[model samples]
Target: MSANRYPLEVDVAIVGSGPTSAAYARILSELAPEARIAMFEVGPSISNPPGAHVKNIGDPAARAAAQRASEGPGAGAATVNSPGEVKAGTRQARPGTFLLTEGYAADGEDGLPVAAMSSNVGGMGAHWTGACPRPGGAERIGFLDDLDALLAEAERLLGVTTQAFEQAPLPQKVRELLAAQVDQDRVAEYRVQPMPLAVHRRPEGQLVWSGADVVMGEATRNNENFTLFDNSLVRRVLTDGAAASGVELSDQLTGQQYQVAARCVVVGADALRTPQLLWASGIRPEALGRYLNDQAQVVFASRLRGVEASQGAGAPGAGLSEQSGVSWVPYTDEEPFHGQIMQLDASPVPLADDDPVVPGSIVGLGLFCAKDLSAQDRVEFDDQVPDFYGMPSMRIHYRLSEADHQVIERAKQQIVRLGHAVGDPLDERPFVMPPGSSLHYQGTTRMGTADDGTSVCSPDSEVWQVPGLFVAGNGVIPTATACNPTLTSVALAVRGARRIAEKLNNSLLMSKSDNRMSE
Candidate 1:
C-alpha cells in the first residue's frame, strides 16, 4: 500500500515519535489492544532493519559521521523548504546517529549552543546518555498531584534501576572518599549516591539502554491496529469547536499534505515544537510558549596525573565499564545544584611507531544548577516566515539570571574542592556551557492544577481550552528540575495516556448504549 493511503481515521493520533509518545503508545496498546492508533514523525524512520547506530556506538567518529549524513545539510542550519534537507559538507555531527536542524533560534539567540535534538523516529531518546534520576521532593512541582505514584510507574516503564553498577565498585569508592573529606552535615544535605540509569543489565553483564524504539518497537510491530508514519510533519491540529478532530500533516520528503481524523490527539513534539505547532494551529493559550526552562550546567574535566590509562580504551566494553563508575551528588532542599562525576576514556590518538602508549584516564564532572521557570524565557513563532514544513519559523528567548550565576560560582567551588580531594585537579577552572546546551528544555506547555492563564495543560495533561487534545513530553513538566527529565516526562505521558484511554472507552460504551436504545 502507498504511504499516502494510510487509514484516514484512527481512535487516537499522536505527533512526534519520541520517548514520551512511545511511552504513551506502549501503555495504550496494553490497556486497549484494539484501539486504532497512528503515530506521526517529522523525520525519516530508522534505517531499515535497525541496529546500525547501535553497532557504531563504539566509534564516536563514525557515529558522528552517520549522524551528519542523516541530518543532511539542514542539520545545523535553518531552511525554508517543505522538509529541511541536510546540506552537503555540514558535518559537525554530535555523538549520535540523529542530526538536529540548526538556525531554529532567532537572531540574538543564535549564538547560544543549544543542545542539538534528534528529529528522527526515536527523538532525543535515540541519542540520550540514559541518565535517569528521580527528582527530589524539593524538585517536584506542587501542582502535579500524585507525583510519587506517577514517578513509580514511570520508573517501571523505563526500566530505571541502579543495578548496572552492582558489580562496578568505582562509584562506591569515590563516594566514600568524598564523604570522608566533606563535612558530615554538608554531605548529608548533598545526598551523594549512585546514579540511577534507565538501562537493563543482562544476565551476561551487558547493559541494554532503553531507547524509545526499544521500548515501543515490539508493541508497534505486534499490534496490527497501530500504525506509524515517518517523515510526516504535522502542521496543525484540526479542531471542531474546542475539541480536536485530527491533524493536517505534510510529507517532509514529498511536500504532500493530508489530513487524518481521530477521536483524540496528542502532541509530544518536544518543548520547542509542541508550542509552535499549537500556535500555528491558532490554539494559542496565554501561556502557550512561555516559562521555558533548561538546566544550566558547569562542566569540569581533569586527567588523573601519575596514572596509566587502560590499553583498550574507547572500546564499547570499556565505555560500558566506565559508565558503571558514574556517581551523582544530588541536589537538596538546601542546595539547588546537582552534580555527576564519571570516568572518561582516552581519546583516539594518532600513534607513531616509536611513540610509547602512555594511556591516561580523565574524570569529568557536571554541576547542573536549576533555573527558575520564567515567563520571559519562551519560544515564539514567526508566521510570516514559514520553515521547511511550511510551519512558522521559531525563535527561542532565554537568559541566565543573577541567582543562576551565583549557583554556578558555588558549583565551581565545589568541583575545585572535590578535584583537590581526589588529587586530580582540573587543568583549568570549570567551564559554563551555553544556555540550552543541557538538552533538558521544559515548561513551555506546563501543567497546573487549574486552567489559569499561566499554564497550558490541566492536571490530566489535556489542553485547558481545547478538549480531546493532550500533550506529553518534557514541556509538560511545570517545574525547573535539576535532574534529567526523561523518566518524569515518560511517566507523565503514561498518566495522560491512561486518561485518554478511559475517555475513549467511555465514549465507546456510550455509543453502544445509544445504538441499542435507538433500535
Candidate 2:
C-alpha cells in the first residue's frame, strides 16, 4: 500500500494491530465516524484475512508455515525438533510459538526467560488460545467507575461464545468432574464450566477463532475512515507540548519513513513493546516499565478414570477433525489461582518420549496463579544496544514473591485434588513452569486512579501528563488477575477509545462554533 500512497494525516494513529488496537479502532471509527484511523502493524499479514487467527488454517503444514512467518524476533527458524527436544518450558513450545530466549539461548538470564510474543497483523491475537474467561474475585479492576459495562461491550466485539464446545461430549464430563472437585474443596461458588471462547462455531463443526479482525468490525471492510498498514513499525509517538500530534512509522519491508499526523495516538503494541516505544519517545514515566508481572503457571496431566483411550474428535493422528479444549475453574478469593482443565485430543503432559498424550489417552490440567505486583520488577531498556528492530534493547526484571510461591503451592494442592477427582495423575504429576510461562504479562504501562509515580496512565488509559497520548493492551491492566487478560484488555481499550472519540467530537464542535462566529 505504501508503494502507491501514504497517509499524511489521520484523526487517530494506532500503533499496533492486535485485540486492544482492534477495540480502539472499533469504538473510535463508529463513534467518531468522520475521524480517520490509521493502524500500523510491524509484521506482515500471515493469514488470508489480514488479522485472522492462524488456528483457522485447515492444513497442518500450512498452519505451521503461517506460524513460521510470525515467530518472535528470538525465533531463528521453526526446526522439526522432537516433542522431548522442544520441551514446554515457561511458555508452551507449540509448533508455531517460541520462547523469547530461543534465539539468544539465554535461559535463566532473566526472571521471565521463556516469555514469548509473535509479530504479525493480529499481534498475539493471531496466536492466542482463544480463552476469553471473565475476571472474578480479586481479578476485577477496582479503579474503574463501571467495569461490567465495559467488559460486556468487549465480549460483544470479540464475538465470545460458550458454544465452542457445547456439542462435545468430553468437555461436559470434564466440566462436571472439575465442578465436583471444586465442591469437595468447599469452593463451589467458583463455578466450573466450559471456557468462554472468542470463536464462531459453524453448524458443520468448524471453529472460527476471533482475532483482531472480529473487534475491527466493519472497519476491516466497509469503513473508508479506517486503514490498516501491515509491515509498518511505529518508531516514535510525536507530541506537541503535552498533546500527542502523531507518529513516525517506517515500512518494515522498505526503510522508508512516513509521518502521519493525528489528533490522538494509542499504543497497544503488547506489554513488552508498549513501554519500550514510550521510553523511546522520551515519555519516560516513573512507572513506564515497572510493576511488570505475570501469572505463575503449574501444569499437570492425568488419565481419565472412566473414558477409554480411543481416537476422539480432533485427536492428533485420529481420523477426526481437531477442536481445542476450553474449560476452567473460575478464580476465587479463597483460591487465588485459577484452574484450567481441558480434554485435548492429545494429552497436554508428556512424561516421556512415548507420552500417552500422543495416543490421546489423558486430560491436562493447568493452574495459573496471579502474581503479587511490585515496583522492583521491571523491564529496562539499554540505549547502547538497539534490538532487532533498532528499538532500545529490552531486559525484563521479574521475580515471584514469597507469597507468589505460596500461591503456587496452594495451586498445586488444588490441581492434585482436581486431578484425583477425574483421573489418576500421570507419572510427571504437577509442576511449576518457569517465570513468564503464563504469557499473560500485564501492568507495565498500568492505569491508576491518579497520575502518581506508581502508575503510567490515568483511569481512562490516557497517559498521565501526555493529554492526547494513550496506552492499551495487557500493559494497561492494573489488576493481578488469574483469568486470561484479553477480554479485560479489550474492554479497557474500548473505554479509552470512547474517551478519545468524545474529545474528538468536542473539538469538532468547538471548531464549528469558531467558524460561525467568524461568519
**Candidate 1 per-residue lDDT over residues 1-519, each given as its tens digit:** 266755788999999887889887888888877789999988765533231223224455654444543453346443212101111223333433222344435555422244455667777776566777888856787766777788887777777777666554445556665566554776453566767776665466555555676557566668888888887889999999889999998877787789999989999988888998999999999898899888887766554454434432333532254323566777776668777666542111111111232222355667788886579888888899876567787677777678877877887888777766555654556667656667788899999878778899988899998999999899999887888898889878888999988987888889899999999
Report the number of the highest-lDDT candidate.
2
lDDT of 2 by residue, 174-273 (tens): 7778776675565544678777778775467555677888888775457888888888989999999988999988888778888889989999998989
Error of 2 at 75 (Å): 4.8
RMSD to truth, every model: 5.5, 3.3
lDDT for model 1: 0.70
